[model samples]
Target: MAALTLALDAMGGDNGPSIVIEALARALEQFPQHHFIVVGDDAELAELLAAKKLSNHPRVTVKHASQTVEMTDKPGYSLRAKPDSSMRVALDLVANDEAAACVSAGNTGALMTKAYFALKTLPGVLRPALMSAIPQASGKSAFVLDLGANPVCDSDTLFQFGVMGAVAAREVLGIERPRIALLNMGEEDIKGNDVVKSTAQLFQQSQLLNYIGFIEGDDLFADKADVIVCDGFVGNIALKSCEGLADLLLSNIRSNINAHWLTRWFVKLFYHRLQRSWDWLKPDHYNGASLIGLRGVVIKSHGDANTDAFFSAIQQAVEETQQDLPARIRDRVESVLLEQD
Candidate 1:
């Protein structure tokens, strides 16, 4: 049997080679069948592997990439000036079929730009959208698309996002006939701007999607909608705001616990319970965000991701590759477009 090869950009992210090496080690132990090609300086990667006592792993290999695309570099400039950068090299591996998937914790904008230009989007997909799952109250996750792809989107683009997001929810969340909702300021038909109103009409008229009504920002965590569709501008704001709120809430809870002797004693009494709750709320649980509608599977991790976060992203890429998520999405999106015509 052929081994599943995953190309990783070792020089990307804030933690650099150390996090990549640690992630590689954890992934190797967890999924022995998946091989990795670390694209970066061969000597540095080798040293990191040796430090982790993972240099002798049979499934691991190193590919030398001399250039590094800095986070501050423009996407177009980086792609043109540094063809041999780790990010470019990793995508090239996928483009040439040398690897099944590409995973990176690099600049989010650069990754999306590189993936779209290098690997290309699937037929009928106007632009690729970034999709991530946000945890809800019912132990279920809601899919939000265009998280940071296109800041401005047309109704047609939003309609396409709805179709793609629905297919993703079905494949990843095992939800059949996933309920779709348009993200708006109000639930009323006349509440939003021209875009939202037009989108609502489009969804209402379509038979292909299970169009639930409009959903406000508060509906995100209420489990009122399963699949939330919005333009990248709105989606990105919502995503970042949610992250900030989570951080603030966690900090406040910790501060309160440590403020009083009685509360600190109470926390000690239920330390395991408190710890479990905190663990459940950690961002690492949802580390991978797919650049959906592309021709291949590309997962983008947080720029400041650690070893565990990188490993989680790799695991997501493995699952997506094994499931042929891009192909599945292509089929669904094309079918929807055909029905409309």
Candidate 2:
């Protein structure tokens, strides 16, 4: 395959362009074949690039944008007011085909709004969904959709989430014929509100989906379902809860380990093993969440992500780009629509 060039919204994250430049260095070291277009204030980004010795790299170039979309900026305002922002410019690279994908650690709402306008959704997709690989206890990843994109979805939209989530799980998580389920209050057929129940009926009627049935929120990370479909409201709450829980557990574990000399020694001795085991639950390990169903690839990095977390997001963009995820979703969507027709 040919080289993949990713556009970076260098000023989007909390740490600003420095971290992006640092993460780009790490990415280049690991993926020399992948190139980058760093978008931000030319003078500041150039200084950081020079400090990192990336000033003259053949694989990296900087694009100057006069503005940045702030973390607290309203999505609508950013879309309407910030035409020359770094985030907008980076997204333009993808839409213009100058870059294969774009990565941003900006305002989630703003990024989504800008991306929706710049890239649009695939044919037959009512709206794009946010999908991420939620780590499971079974050493597998559960692909969950609408993590925080569309707050309210109809039955048809939910069904489409299932299809798109399944395709993404298969492509990114390597889950063959991924078993799918809708997130609900209970697993019983009679549970959940009308929209979910109607969606379940649609899934059952479809010959294209591998829909299994309804699954509770607990089933999200239990390996009960490879792909969990829910409206953004529920999925977002679940996602935030999971992340907060993981942090709490890790914090408690670290505190206890440091509370005693004996436990500290044991931790040191088994550091690598424990580290490997706990890495699965770390937020940084799964930092990138794709804006799935878009016409082009867009990976959202956490607004406050560190260098390691941002690097992981870059890796995600590379993997999804290699998989040609947008095209795969488009094809599956067309297939389902044809079947329904």
Candidate 3:
């Protein structure tokens, strides 16, 4: 297999180029079959690379970008104003076929705007979706989509998301005939609004999907369904809620364990075991979210991700590119359309 090259928006994330550089160093060691192109201010990125001893590394390359889109910059402004922005340049790398994929922790809207314009959507795809995996009890990840991409989606859009999610689950997660469900207020048929109800009808009617009816908020990680589909507004809130709950639980556990000397000693005795159990729940372990239904692979890393978390995003890019995710999606979508015809 040929070595995959990923373009990184080195100046996009909260910590700027330093964190991206750190991730690059770790990625180079972990994934020997991959190379990277870092885009940012030449002098700053060079200094960070030198400090980390990655400046002379063979697998790393740098592309000088003069401007940067700030975290607060609007998507439209960034698109029109900053032509030389690192995020735009990185996406350009994928568009030009110079890199297999691209990764960024920049403003979500800005990244999406630049990416959609640069790569376009896959054929038969109405729009692109933001899909991420949430760890389930069965040791498999349940795929969810439209996470903040299209806040107000109609029935057709939701159905399209289901198709894309199913293909991704099969190709990337290796699930055979993945069970799909619509996220609703209740498990009953008469639970959600007209949009969800109509989408459910479409899923049930389509032979391409394994439609399993409605799933509630609690079933998200229950492993009851392999894929969950919903509008972006609901999906984004659910994602953020899970992240908040995980943080709260970790903080509460730490505070309780050290509240008393007796409990503190007990916790220390089983610290390793507890830590191993909690590792699965950490957000960093599932840091990458793929913008599916695109012409090329684009991974969105959490803005505040650390070195390890960002590397996980890069791993996602490598795997999806190797799997040729977009081609699989296009094929599945065309099959569905032909079935309808």
Candidate 4:
């Protein structure tokens, strides 16, 4: 196989260079054949690399950019006004085939906007959706799409998401005939709004997808579905709610144990078990979300991602690159769209 080069948007995310630098170092150690082109201001990146003693790595290089698009900046304005921004430069690398993939922990909206405009989409793809995998109960994970990519979507768009998500599950998760479900308010066929009802009907009729009917929010971690499709608005709400509930459960568990000496002793007895369970639920374990249906691979990490999260994002980029996710999704989407035509 050819060498895989990844473009890292160094100026992105809340932690900036620190998290990116750490992730680069860690990834280089794990996958020595992989190379990275860090995009940011030359002088600042150089100083940081020197401080970390990473300037000598053969697999790492820096590409300088003078400006950065802030998280609060409007996606359209940033893409149009700041042509030389790190995010734009990163996309250019993938567009020109200089990089196998691009990863950013920046403004999700801006990154997706830039990617869609610069790289465009597969021939028949109406829109690209962001798909992220979340850990479930059976030592497995579920893929959720439109996780803040297109907040408002029509039935056709949701149907596209289902196809794109199923392709991703097969490629990334190595699942044959991956089970798919639409995110809905009820399990019955006539439960959701018109968009959901229409999309459900489409899935039910389509032979390309393994549509398993409606899945409510509670079924997210039940392992009933391998890929869950929803509009970006509902997907974002589901993701945030899961994270919030995880935090609350962990806190409640800790507080209950600390309330009394006997409880503390019991907690200490089961500390390792508790830690193991909590580790499985941490966001770091599943840190990367791919923007599906684009011409190239673009993985987005959380803005508040730590070093571990950044590292996991890099691993995800490598895995998706190896799986050739973009090509797989393109093929699947083309087939479905052709059938519709």
Candidate 5:
């Protein structure tokens, strides 16, 4: 792939610019074809980059922002008061077409607010929903969207999410005719409240999407649906629950592996294979969530992400940018809107 430009919110995460700088260094090595712009307090970012021997790297640029977005800041406050924040500056690079995408491990609400403001929603999109891929049982990936981006979505918005999710799966994950399902209490068409039932009706009416009715929480990773759509309220909880379950499984597996000498010896013998399994289950492996339905690509990383997790976020930005995700979404949304009209 050709070299793509990305902006990094150096001062956004809890661990400071140190982790972001370190991740950039790692990403530079792994993706030698990419260019990166690091946005933050110029002095501090320069110092950190120098420490990592990336101060004068050919593909790296440092941009100065006067402020940082605190984790506790409200979305409205951060959007209104901190225009020069690292988060906002990084987002500006994307808006100005200086960067293909921006990755920020900042406050989710603030990031969403600023990103939606800076990038604007794609035509016909009611809101820019956040989406992240989840590993599936068939070793494929399923996408879940509205991940805390829009807490209260109406039927129209939910229907739009399903369309966007399908387009995302088809473009980004190479899933043709991606099966779309609404996340609900039960799998039956009659299981949900009015909002969900109404959303399902819209999906069923659409010929552009592969509407597969509803799926319960248990089917999240069952590969039953290629695209899972829900409001931010339910989607965020589902995402967190998956992460928590992964942690729990890892913890229990480790505990059992060391509980007996035979088990320990067996693990040691198959350590490499077991390590692959562990790596697959690590939540850090999938740390970036895309703010979809926008005119530009924006990736929201976990606020407390470490170097590896942050690097994964950068990787996601690159992947989405390379796939031209926003354009695909824009085109699909236009198509869906025309279908509705």
Candidate 6:
């Protein structure tokens, strides 16, 4: 992947343009092969960039957007009223081919709504799903999807998510012949609702997918499956639960280290090592989720993402662009369809 341009919604995150510009500074240094076009309130973004000494940087350009999408804005309302908003404008740049991808930490619903309209879904794609790689305790990560994109999904939609997730696992994560699994209450042959049963039948019948059996929520990071498929409702709850658990554990560990003298001494001895391990377990480490199956790359960072998390989202967008993920998913879906025919 040679040099490519990426559009950024500079006003999207909770910390405002300051975090975005700071991340851009780091990205510009780290990914010299990429150019950035940041969309936001021009004056504000310019000042922020100037503070980072990126205003005159050759690899970056600032585009003025009159509006900012708020976290509380309704998805439909944001789309209808904020055409020139930073989030919308950033996506428009992708749609017009002025940028290879867009990265935003804006409202997920608003971003998804605009991206569907702006970039459109790929041919043969029913709906774009939010896919993210969750770090596993087993020393490898697995890809999971439908992370709050569609609360209601039919068997066919879930199957399509399986295909998309597998392609992503293979292309993005370099997992060849990725094992795809349905997230269910149990791994038994007769364990789930009608939709899960139907989706299992579909996956089991598909010769292309490495369809493993169902996995319970406890197995999410067990690395038993390369790609876990679920409806958005389940996925969203599961992911947030994992994040919350991670936060709770981190907080407890820090609070407990000094609660016992022996424990305090032990932690002081291995403090650096334990801290390094704990840092990777944080919610912000890999914060971006790709809105896959779109015509262009769109990475949605957590709305309250810090600089590191936002930068991770930018990296996610770049990796997807480099892999030509849309093309891969589109072609794979075409192949699957033709095979069925």
Q: How many residue pairs clash in each candidate?
A: 0, 0, 0, 0, 0, 0
Deviating ranges (above 4 Å) for candidate 2: 258-261, 264-279
lDDT per model vs. reference? 0.86, 0.90, 0.89, 0.88, 0.89, 0.90
Candidate 5 clashes between residue pairs 3 or more apart in a chain or in different chains? none
Q: Which ten residues in a row have the lowest lDDT in candidate 4?
A: 277-286
Which TM-score value belongs to model 2? 0.94
Considering summed lDDT, which 10 consecutive residues are worst modelled in model 5? Answer: 278-287
In terms of TM-score, the best-performing candidate is: 6
Report the Cα lDDT for residue 290, model 6: 93
What lDDT tens digits, residue by residue, belong to model 1 across residues 1-341? 34699999999997787898998989989887879999999999989999988787799989999998888988888878989999999999999999989999988888988999889988998889998888789988888888988999999899889988898888888889999999999988889889988988888878888999899998887887778999999999987887777778777888988999998989867655766665445543347788988878898887888887888899889888877888888898888888878
The window of 10 residues in a row where model 1 has the poorest summed lDDT is: 277-286
Residue 252, model 3: lDDT of 88
Worst 10 residues of 2 by lDDT: 277-286
| lDDT score for residue 334 of model 2 | 96
Candidate 4 residues 34-71, lDDT tens each?
A: 89999998888888888889996798989998789899
Whole-model alpha-carbon lDDT for candidate 6: 0.90
* Residue runs of model 6 more than 4 Å from their true location after superposition: 265-276, 282-285
Q: What pairs collide in candidate 1?
A: none
Write down the RMSD of candidate 5 (Cα, Å): 2.1
Model 4 local distance difference test score: 0.88
Off by more than 4 A, model 3:
269-279, 282-285
Off by over 4 Å in 5: 254-279, 282-285
Please identify which of the two predictions, 5 or 6, would achieve the higher lDDT against the true structure.
6
* Selected candidate, larger lDDT, 2 vs 4: 2
Question: For model 2, which pairs clash?
Answer: none
Tens digit of per-residue lDDT, candidate 2, span 25-142: 9999999788999999999998999999889899998999999999999999999999999999999999999999999988999999999999898889999988888788787788
Q: What TM-score would each prediction reach against the true structure? A: 0.94, 0.94, 0.95, 0.94, 0.93, 0.95
